[model samples]
Target: MKKQVLSYWLKDSQKKTYPRLEKNLNVDILIVGGGITGILCAYQLAKQNKYRIALVEKNRLYHSTTGFTTGKVTVQHDDIYHQLIKNKGETIARAYYQANSEAVQGLKKIVEEENIDCDWVDTKAILYAFSEEEAKRLQREQNAYDTLGIPYEWLDKETLPFQTLGGLAIPDQGVFHIVRFLDGILNNLNVDIYEKTKIIKTNPTEKGAVAETADHYKISAKHIVLATHYPIYKRFNFYFTKIKPTCSYVAIAHEFAIKPENAYINLIDPVLSIRFLDSADPKLMVAGFGHDVKNYYSYLDQIHKLKAMATERLGAKDFTEEWYNQDYESMDMVPLIGKITDAPLYLATGFRKWGITSAFVASLIIKDLIEGINNQYAYLYDPNRNKNTFKTVCYNFAMLSTVIKTKLLTVPKSIKINPGNGRIIQHKGSKIGLYIDQNGKTYSVKPICTHLGCTLRFNNVTKTYECPCHGSRFNYDGTSLDGPAVRNLTQL
Candidate 1:
C-alpha cells in the first residue's frame, strides 16, 4: 500500500515560506502556533491596528490538523446538543450552538468581503443513526433543538447510499477549503509570520512574557497565545491530564459511485463521516474510527479499516489520498479557551475534533479578552474552570494504567519483527525502538517519549513512534513530528 499524501485542499496550493527569527524581538502579542486559531486571532488583532503582532509556527502554516480535516464547517457535532443540554443546561447549550453558527456566518461574510475562492458551500449537515439506541439518542437531540428554538428536520430514511434507522438534518451549515480561507486571511493581514520556528519555552516577566525558540532567539510580548493544538506547558494547566488526544483516520477516493449532497456523520460508535469534494463530481471524503492514541497497537489497521469502509459501504474506488489527524478532546466536551489562570499566557485547545468553528470562536474570545472587551461566551470556555473534576479523575486513572502497563510490559524475545516495520524490544536492560526498511537497513532510537518520558509505541503505518502520555510523535530517525515535545528523541 502507498503511504499518505497531502490533502486535496493543499495539493494545488502554493507553499509560502517565511523567514526565521534571527534575533530577539519585542511585540505587543506573540502567537505560538500558525493554525486557524492563531491566524484568525492575528487577523482580528491586526484589523484593529492597535498592536504589533508576530506569529511563529513549528512547521508550515496549515500543514497540521487544520489542513488534514474533513473540511466540514457546521454546528451539528454528532448529536451534541442532547449531551450539552444534559450536562450544562439549555442556556449554555444554546450559547454553544449560537457560537458555532455565528462562526459559520462570520466565515461566510469574510469569504464574501475578501473575495476568496475556497469552494464555500452552504450545504446541510446530517447525523444518522445505525441502531435503535442511537436513533433514540438522536430523537433526544431533536428535542434539544426544540428547546433551543433551532430549526432541524428529523428523517426516518433518506437517499443515502447506506441504511440508517433515522437521521437529523440541520440547514445553513457549510464546508470550505480551510487552507484557502486561511491563506487569504494571512495574505490580507499585516502580521509578521515565521515558519519552522519551534518555541521551546515561555516564561512570564514582570511586565510581560518571553518566548524562547529552539535556536535561542527570544520574543518578548505583552501577551502570549498558545494556539498549538496541544499546549506545551503542562504544569500550569495540567492539560496533559485533562485533555485526551485521539488519533483519527481519513481517506479521499476518486471515481466514487455515490455523490453526497450534504456532510454526513453517524451517531454510533466508531463513527463514520462522509462528504463530497464537489456536488457535481464523484470525489468523496470519508473519515472517522477514532481511538485514544495510547490504545492503538497498529496504525495500519485503522487506515485499512477506513479504506475498507469507504469501498465496501460507500462504493468508493481508487483512493487518491489518505491521512491521519490527531485532536484533543476536552474532558467537559466544551473547548478550553481563555486566560491561563490570570497569567499573561493564553491558550486555545481541546476542541473535541471540532476545531474549525471552535477555532473561530476561540479567536473571538481571545481578542475580546486582550482588548478588555466583555464577551458573553467567555465563561463557557474558561480554561481554569473545574466543573468536571469527575471526568478529570477518571482520565487520570486511565492514563496511569496505560503508563504503568507500558513500563512493565514485556515482549517475547522469540517474536520476529517483519521487514519494513517497527517494534519495541528489550535490550541491555532498557527498551530500544527498532525499525527496518524494505531494503533491510536498520534504524534504531530510544523508545521513550521526549515530552513526559512516556513509553513510545511503534506506529507501522506512519513509521513513527507515538506517545501515549501526551501524543508527542517522533520519526524513525528520532526527529520530532508533533509536540508537547520540543526536543527529538535521543538516538540509541
Candidate 2:
C-alpha cells in the first residue's frame, strides 16, 4: 500500500489553481503569499474596491502551512496567558486574548454572513495537563484568564480518551476546514490572484515597492505585503535571527472510537493537539512532536513516534493521512505583525504554530495600517517592538552555534550512501550534499544554505537540504523549497 503523504484537508477538498503572472501589471497593493493570512488580507482589501489588489503565490493556494494545519481556531495557545501576564503585563495579556477572541468572532460572523459551509463548529478549547508541573501551570493560566475577565471553565473530569489531571476550557472557540473557508472568501472577493508566481526580489520605489518575479515580470504596487510564511527579505528585518523554525508532524485516523467534545491540547513536553472533523465520515487529527527542524536525526523516525503514540494511546488502527508542518516561533513569543521597519513593505509571520487566529489578527492589523485606520492591537505585534535583549541574545547565540557546528563538523570520507537517501560529505576539501535515487542515479550540490551561507544538512525523510541556522530548505536538485532562502543551493 502507498503511504498517505498529504493532509486530509487537501485530499477531501477541491483545490483551485490560478494563472501565473504572464505580464507586468501595477496594483495598489501586492500580497506575496496565498495562505490564509495573505488571502484574508486580499479579501478584506479587495472587498472595498478602493484599490486594485493582486495576490501572487509561489505555489497552489493554501498548500503550505495553512493546508497542513490541524485546523483548531482557538485563542488558548498552550498555557500562554500565564507567561504573557508575567512577562509582558496584564494589559498586554488581556489585549492578546481579546485580539484572538475578536478574530474568532469576526471569522464566525463572516462564515455566517457568507453562509460558508466549511464544517465550521463552535466548541470549547481545552488545555489539559498530564504532569503535576503542567497542572500547576494550567492553574496559573486559569488565574490569568480570571484576571483578564475571560470566561472559562475549570474541569477535573473530561470526555477525552486519555486521563488528565485537570484542564482549562475557553468556550466558543472553533475548528474548520481552512482551505474551504479561505476559498469561500476568495470566491466572493475580486482580487487578482496568481499562483506559481515566485517573487524573486522586491525593490522599494519612491511611491511604493516593485516586486520582481522569477520570470522577470515586475509588479509595481503602492504597497507590498510579505505574507509569505518566512519573510524573503532578510537585511532590513533580520527575521531569520528573530524567528526560529520548528517542524511538527500530524496524522489523521478515521473512525476514532473516542471523540472528545472539544478541541484539545496538552501541557506535556511534546505537546499534542486533538481535533475531530465531522464530514461524511468522522476523522480525528492528532498533531505534535515538534522539534527544531535541524535537530531531528530522521523525519521518518519522528513520524513513526507520532504514529505509535496515536495507535497506542488514541485507539487509532491506522492513519488515513499523515504530513509534517513547519512553523516559526519568535524569540519574544508574540507574533511579529506590522510594517517592516517603517517601510511600505509589511510582514506577518512568527505565529508559533498558532496561526489560525494570529493570521486573522494579522490581516486586520495590516489592513488597518495600510488604510490609516487605528488598530489598538498593532503595538502588541509590532515587528520592531522593544527588544527583549536577553532572549534575542540567546537566540542569536543559538543560531551562531548552529552555524559554527555546521561549518566545523567533519564530514564522512568514504561512506556508501544508499538509494532513496541523502547525506553531506567532504569532497575536494569542501562539504557536498549527495543523494541517490531509487534507480541509482546520483545528484550532488554544495552543502551550503543560499540564505546565509550556513552549512546544509540532509533531511532523510523529505530528501531535502535543510539549513540549521534559519530553516531554509532546498530540493536535492538544488531548487529552493522554503525560505528565508530565495536562491537555490549551488550545484556541484
Candidate 3:
C-alpha cells in the first residue's frame, strides 16, 4: 500500500500472502524469489514428484516486475533476432527464437490443462519502424526471420494508425492478464511458499547449498535456484557489473478504439510499447521507453509524456493506472540463465522486458538440469559464457567511470529544499541525502549505494532514492525497497 505507483493489473486484485520461514528448514530444492520464474519453477518441480521444492519471497509475491508488465506473451522481442545474429551468432539467434517459440506454446498447454482463467488469447505481435533508418533495420530483421523460417506478415504505412515507415507482425502470439495467470498457477501449487523471507547470503556446501536469510534463518537444500531478476549474490557471475539495470514506465487507458488488435512495439530509443485489452474492462496499455536506471529523470515527466503520446496518437481516453518496472539487461542483450556457480545453484536474470517467455524457458531449463537431462537451449543462455564483447567492456568501463566521476564531484556548502521534496546536500563532511516531507518532517541518510558504493539519485515522482548504477532503491527513511542491495542506506 505504501508503493508509489499502482499497476493496472494489481489495482483490482486481492493481495495474496504466504507464511514466512521463521525457523531453519531443509528441502530437496530451495527457490529464492517468488516472481513468475520462481513460482513456475516450483510448480514444475513440485508437480514432477521429484524435488521437495520450497519457494521464498523477500516481499509480497507477484508485486514486483511481474505485476507491472505489458502482459504480451510473444516471442517477438523488438528485432532481437537480427541483433542477436549480428552480436552473438546465427546459431545462437536461431536457438533464441526456437526456445522462446516453444515456451510460448508450452505456456498455452499449461493454461489449457489447468483451465486457468487469465483471459488468454492468441493474437498477433507487431514490431513497427518509426523512421527510414528503422525500416532498413526492419528489413535486415526480415532477412534474419527468413533464415530462421519464422513466419511474419509485413505492413505498410497505411496499415497502422500512426507510423512513419512499416512494421512486421508475427501470428500465434498471445496476451493475458499475467498477474492473474501467475496467481492462477500459484494458488494451486502443492509446494510450500514463504513470503517476506529475504535470503541475504548463500554458501556452497559439500552436499548442496545453504542460503541464509536476513533474519539469520537458513535453508539447506540439495539445489538452489536464484530466479530473482538480479541474483543478489555479488561474488559470483559479477552480476552487478555484467547486468545493467534498466527501468521503464507504463500508463493505462480504459477507453480506446483501435483496429487489428495486436501487441506492438516501435523501433525507437526507449521504444514505446503498446498492447490492448479486450477483456470485460477493455483498455489500452502504453509503456514508456526503457532507460538505464543510472540515468535519472523526472519520473513525473515520463508519465506526462506517455499520456500525451497516447492521447495524441492512439486516441486514448482518461488514464486509469500507471507504474514502473525495472528489468535487468545483459551486455549482449540476451538473458543469463542456468547455473552460474560450481555449486548446484542456478540463476536466470537480464530478461529485459520479455519475461514471459524467458521465465517459462527458465523453468523448463532448470527442471531439465534438476533431472540431469540436457537441454539444447542451455548453451545459448549460459551465464558463464565469455561475455567480453566490445559492448560489455565498454559498458562496464562506463559504469566504473560513473563511480569515479561521481566521487570527485564538488558539493555545495549548503542547500535548501521545499517541503515534500528530496535533495542531496553536504552534511557532516560528506554529501548525504535529505527529504523534507509535506508535513515538514525531515529524513536523512547517506547517499552511497550499499551494493556498489555508487552515488544515489533521487526519483522525485516516486519519492524514493535509487542507485544510478545497479537500480537499488530505498525509501526516504532509508529502508531498502529494491535490490541487489540487501542493506538500507545508513540513516544520518
Candidate 4:
C-alpha cells in the first residue's frame, strides 16, 4: 500500500545505493540499520575522525519507520512525565525529560550547523484530553509538569481552536523532514555505506566480530551496533522477550483545509497525533497513530474511524495516501541503548513508538561508547539492565498469552477461499499460508516466520499472517510482510 507520505519526499530525498559486502574487510565499527539512529551515529562517529564505520541496511535507507514518522521532534509525549513520576520516580522522570529535551536541541543544532533545508520549524505541541476521566489525568500531568519545572501552557475549550475540554501545550517544539536531515548527514561522509547487504549470520570470535552475508563475504569490525530496529542478534540481549513489536498507521491528506498551527496528540484511549507539512504544490496534514499490529483485528475498526475523524476534523477533501509502520515497544517504556555484552557489541531498540528523539539519543550514546567516554544516561537504556518489576512481568505475561491464543486459535486446516480471500492452511506438519484469486487459482507460500522460524497465523480482519514468536508479518499471498524478517515468504 503506497501511503501519501512518499510523495512528500520522493523528489528531495537522495537516491544513493551502497554496494553489499562481498569480501572480507575491516573497519573500526559496523553499524547495522540505516535508519535515523545508525545514520546519525555514523555521521557523529565520522566527525571524530577516529573510527572507520560501515553502515548496512537490509533495504533502502529512510524507507523504514524513520521515513514514515509524524516528524514531531519534541520532548512533549502524551502525558509521559506524570506516568513516569508515578511508576519510576521524580529523579528518573526528570532525567527522561532532560534526555529528550537535549535530544530535541541536538537535532535542531545539527540541522542548522549542516545547513539542511528540511523545512524545520519551531511550534508548540498540544496534548488534548477527550474525556472527563482523561481531563482529570491531565490535571495530574499538569502537577507533574509543575514539579519538574517544565514550561507549558494549560488551556480550556474556550482558549483553543479545537473542542477538547482541556489540554496541555508545550512551546518551542519542532518538526522536520527526517530524510532530509539524514541526507544532510550523509552528503559527503567518508563512511563505507552498503545496501542490499543482508547480514545472514554473526559469529563472535575471541578477538572481535565477523558478519557473514549470503554473498560470501566476511566483514570484520572491532565493534558492532545492532540498530536493525529489533536487533538481529537475539542471543545476546533476549530482545524478543524484553521488547515486543507493534505497528501504527499514518495518512497524509493534501486537500485538507484549516490546518492547526502546531503538532497535536490526544490523551484519550484511541489516540490521534497530528503534524503539518509544507510540500511543493499543496500543504499536507499528516494524522495517524492507530492499529497496534500485534492486535491488528482489535483496532481494525479504529483505523477506519480515525480516517473518518481526520477527514472531518481537518476538513480533508480527499485522502491521498495511507501507510503503516511497525515499531518495537520496550517493557519499561524507554529505549534500549548500550552494549548488549562484554564483546564490543551494542544495540538501540524499543523507542516505544517515539523514534525521532530516541534515535537522537542513541546516536549520542553510540558515539560515547566508541570514544570510550562515560555517558551518564547509559544505565537508563542498558540492554542487560533487566529490573523486571511486577508491571513488566504482567505486561509480558499478557503478551505471551495473547500470542499463544493467536497461534493456537482454531483456524481451519484448509479452507476453500475465494479469489479475493485468504486461508490458513496446515501443511508440511506446519502451518502454511494460501491466497486465491477471483479465478479460484491458489498461491501457496511458507507461513513460517523469517525470525525464529515460528509458524504464523492468519489475521481475518486485516488479511495478514503474523508471527507469534517475534511479531513478523506476511501478506496473504505468502509475501514477507515486516522485519527482522528480511525476505518475502518463499512460494511452495
Candidate 5:
C-alpha cells in the first residue's frame, strides 16, 4: 500500500485558487487569515448585504488547521462544561453551550439551505471512560448539563473493543466534509478573497486601521479581524502569554470492520478522539495524541500508540495516511473572540481542537460585534476578559525556562549529520539549524524564533522547525509554515 504523510482530507480534495493582493485597496472590513473563522466571518458579514469585506490569506484555503481538523460538527468538546462552570461563571459556561449548539444548527441549516454536496452525516456524540475516576467525572459533567438544561442520555455500555465503565451521550450532533462545506459557502459568498497575501502588520489610524502586506501593499479598512489561529501580532493583545499551542497527529485506517454510529472521545490523557468518513470511501480516523509544539519529533511516537489502538480495537488493517496539525488553546479552555484591546481589530482563537462549532460561534459573535448588536455570548467569548494574572505569569515563566535551557545547552559540539537528517550546531558562537535532504542538499537556518527569539526545535517527521514559546513553525528551507511567527528563519 502507498503511504501519505498529509491529511487524508487535503490529499483527497480539489484545491481552489484565489488571486494574491498585488496593490493597495480599501474596504469597510478587512479580515486577516482564511481559516474557518475568517471565512465564516466573511460569510456572515456578506449575508447582511453591508460592509466592503476583503479576506486575505497567507496561503490557499484549506492549507491550514481548517483542513486538518477531525471534521466533526458536534457540541461535545471532550468534557469541558464542568471545567468551564468551575473556572468561568455559570452564565459564561451556559452561553458557551448555547452558542456552540446553535452553531451546529446554523451549519446544518446552511447545508440544507444551500443544498451543498458536502457529505453530511448525523450522529450522536459520545464520551466514554475506561476508569472509575473518569466515570465519576462524567457524572459531575452530567450534573453540569442538568444545571444548564442541556439534553443528554446515559451511556451504560460502549461498543468499542475495550472495557469501559460508562459514558455520556449527546444526541443530534453531526459530522461532514468541512472542506466541502466551506467550498459550498465560498461558491455563494459575495466577498473578495486574496490568497498568498500575508498581512505583516497593522497600524491604528484615527478613522480605522491599515494593514501592510508582506509585499508592502496596504489594505485600509474600518475594521480588521485577526482570525489567524495564533495572533500574528506579537505585543498588542498579549495573547501569546495566555495561549498554548500543541502539535497533534491523526491517522486514517481503511476497510476497518468497526463502524460507529457516533463520534467518540475518551476522558483520558493523551486523548483518543475517533470519528468516521462514510461516502465513496469508508475510513476510520483516529486522532489526539499530542505534545506541546516544542516537543515536536520527540513525542511523535505517541501517535504510533494511537495507531496500535485502532489496529486492536477496530481491526484496522490498512493505515495509509498519517499527518500532524497544530492547535491553540487558552489556559482557561474557553475560546477568545471579539475586539483586540477594544479596537476595530478583532481575533477569534483558542478553539482547542473543536474549531467547527467554535468557528461558527466566532463568526456570529464577530458579526454582531461589528454590527453594534449586543450578542448574548459576546462578553463570554471576549478576548479582553480579565482573568487570573498568575496563569499568565506562570506561562511566561515556563517560557523563560525554555529559553534559558536552550541557550545554556547551545555550546559548540562537533557532530556529523547524515543525509535525510538534521541537527543544530554552534557556528561561530551562533546556533545554526541544518537539514540535509535525501539528495545530499543542505539547508541552513538560524535556530531561533522570529517572534520571541526562542530557540527553535526541529521536527524530524514534519521537517519543520517549531517554537515552543509561541508555536511558530518553519519548513526545512526556512520558510514560515505557521504562526505567531510571521517572519521566516534567517538563512545561515
Candidate 6:
C-alpha cells in the first residue's frame, strides 16, 4: 500500500533537520502551527521590529498545508461571492474581496521585495459553471464582484478551450512556488522557530500563557496564535463545533501537460480543482473527491475514481503523487480570525479550502490584534461571533452528536469474532466493524477512533469503517484513512 501521497518536491531534494526546544524561554509573542498561517504570523510580527516572536511547529516547517497546497495563491474561490452577497450583502462580499485582494498584493510585494524566485506568476483565475443554475450563480457572483469594485471579465461558451457554459475570469490572479515563498520569509526572521515539537498541554498564567511541549519545556508568551491546522487546545473555543472538515484527494500526473495560463475549479458539487505545476515536464494537479475524513474508504475510493477520471478524461498517462489533505469549512462561509475570548488567546481557522488567501488576511488581522492596531475586518471574523442561523445550529449539533456518540458507544462481539467484509455486527450491546480480507483472513480491532476515541461505524457505500468523532476513519485491514487521528486502528 502507498504510505504517503507522492509529492513532487520530495524528489531530488536534500533532507534538512531542524532543532527542538530544550529550554524554558519567554517571548513577547508566540505563534503555533508552522504552516502558511503560523509562518505568515511570524513574518508580519517580525516586520514591526517591536516584539520578540517565537514560532513552534510540531513537524517540519512549511511541510504541512503550505507545502501540500495546489499553490494557486489566487483570490477567486468556488463561486463563494454569491453566497456572501446573498447572506450578508454586497458590503461583506466586498470586504472578502478587499481582504483577499490585499493578500494577493501582499504576496506580490513579498516576491518583488525579497527577490525570491519561487516561479511566481501573474495569471487569470477562472471559475467554470457547468449547469445553467450554476451559471446564474456565476452571474450573481460577477455582480457581487462588480459591486465590490473587483476587476473581472465574463467569458461565454466558445470563448475558452474547454467545454463549459461560461466562466468568470479574475485578472491578475496568480500561482507560485509555496516552498520558496516560505523559505524566503523564514530565512530572514529573527524569530525563534522550533520543529519536531508537539505541544501536549497549554494553560493561561497570571501574566501571559504557558505552552508545555512534549520535550518538557514551558514556553510563555503574552499572546498565542493556534495555527495548527487543527488547534491542539480543546476546551474553550469549541472549534470542533463551528467547523466541519473534509479530506480531499490529489494527484499529480505527467500526461496532458499544459500549465494553463490560470487555474480552475468547478462551481458545483463534487468540486474539481485543476492547476499546473511549473517544471521541466509541467505536471498537472487534479484534485477532487472531498468528503469527511471519517469516511476513509469513501475518500480513498473517490481518489481512485479521480485517478481513473484523469486517465480517461484528462489523459493522465502516469501519476507521480497521490495524497490526501484536510480543510475546515466554516459555518459562516468566512474565516474565523480574532480572539477566542476576551483573553489573549487568538485563533485563525475555518478557511474553507481557501487558506492560502485567507491565511494572508489572517496574518494581517492577527498582527494588528497583537500590535493593538484596530483592524476593520477583525469584528467580521471574530471567533466568538455567535450567530444562531438554522444552518449553523444544525452543523454544530451534528458535530456534538458525533462527538458524544463516538465516546460513549461500544463495538459488538459479532464484529469482534469475525470482522467480516467491512460490515458492522452486534457484539454484547455494541455495534462493531468486522472485516474479512481477500485472503480469507479475519481480524478484529477496537472499532473506535484513535483521535478522540470515538466508536467506529461501517460505511457500506465507502467500504470503510468511519469514526463519527472528529472524523478519523480506517480501511478493512485496520489501516488509517485520515486524521485528526494520526495512527491506524489497533488489531485484536
| Reference-based TM-score of each model | 0.94, 0.94, 0.94, 0.89, 0.95, 0.84
lDDT over C-alpha atoms for residue 239 of model 2? 75
lDDT of each residue in 1-492, candidate 1, tens digit only: 354555777774557789987889899999989988899889888989989999999878878778888889999988888899899998999999999999889888888999988888888898888778888888898899999998888776765557778688899988887888888887788999998898988888888889999899999999999999888764464678778888788888875666567889987666789888865565788898888887844656787888887787777778878888799988888999998875788899989889989999999999999998999999999988874599898988888888887787685443477788888888877889998889888888998887778888887767888888878888887888775787888987
> lDDT, candidate 6, residue 31?
89
The TM-score of candidate 4 is 0.89
lDDT of each residue in 1-492, candidate 3, tens digit only: 232368777764557778888999999999998888898899889889866888999888877778888889999998899998887788989999999999899898888988888888898898888777888989999999998899999988798777458789899999988877888898789888999888988888999999998889999999999987778765654677788888888988866657537788987775678888756667788997678876656688777887787777778777877788788888887889998657889999889888989999999899999889999999888998765777778888888877776677666667778998888877768888889999999999998888878888777667888887778888888877676888879998
| Candidate number that wins on TM-score, 1 or 5 | 5
Please give the lDDT score at residue 204 for candidate 1: 87
Query: Rank by lDDT, descending?
Result: 2, 1, 3, 5, 4, 6
Q: How do the residues 313-381 of candidate 2 rate in per-residue lDDT, one tens digit apiece? A: 677655777888789989878999998764689999999999989999999999999998999999999
lDDT of 4 by residue, 2-48 (tens): 34434355446888777876677788899888888888888888889
- Model 5: residues >4 Å from true position, as ranges? 158-162, 296-300, 410-420, 438-440
Which has the higher lDDT value, candidate number 1 or candidate number 5?
Answer: 1
User: Which segments of model 4 are wrong by more than 4 Å?
Assistant: 1-12, 279-286, 289-291, 298-300, 409-423, 426-430, 435-443, 452-454, 457-465, 474-491
lDDT (tens digit, per residue) of candidate 5 on 1-492:
797777767764558789999999999999998889999999999999978999999977868888898899988988899988998868878888988999999999999998988889988898888677788888888999998888998877654444577778899999898888888898999999999998888877888899999999999999998888987654465777788887678888886776545788887765678888866678888887777765534545776887887777667778888888888888888888888774678889899888999999999889998898989988888787755567877877888877776566653465888888887778876789999999999999998988778888777777888787778888888888777778889998
- Model 6 lDDT per residue over 1-492, tens place: 233455555442234456898889898898888888998889889999989888888767866556667788788977788788888887788788888989998988988998877788788898887778878888888887777777888988788656678888898888887877777777788888888776766677778788888778988989988887766565563566667777677888777634355788777666667877885547788887777654435545787887886676556667767776667877788888887665676778888788988999999999999888999888778877765668778876677666775555554455333323566666666555566766768666767776767777776534566666565557766666443554567876
Backbone clash pairs for candidate 6 read: 5-322, 412-427, 412-432, 413-427, 419-434, 419-435, 420-434, 420-435, 421-436
Q: Which structure is stronger by TM-score: 2 or 3?
A: 2
Alpha-carbon lDDT, every model = 0.84, 0.85, 0.84, 0.75, 0.83, 0.75
Greater TM-score among 2 and 6 belongs to 2
TM-score of 6: 0.84
Select the stronger candidate by lDDT from 2 and 4: 2
Better of 3 and 4 by lDDT: 3
Report, for all candidates in order, the number of backbone clashes: 0, 0, 2, 5, 0, 9
Deviation (Å) of 207 in candidate 2: 0.9
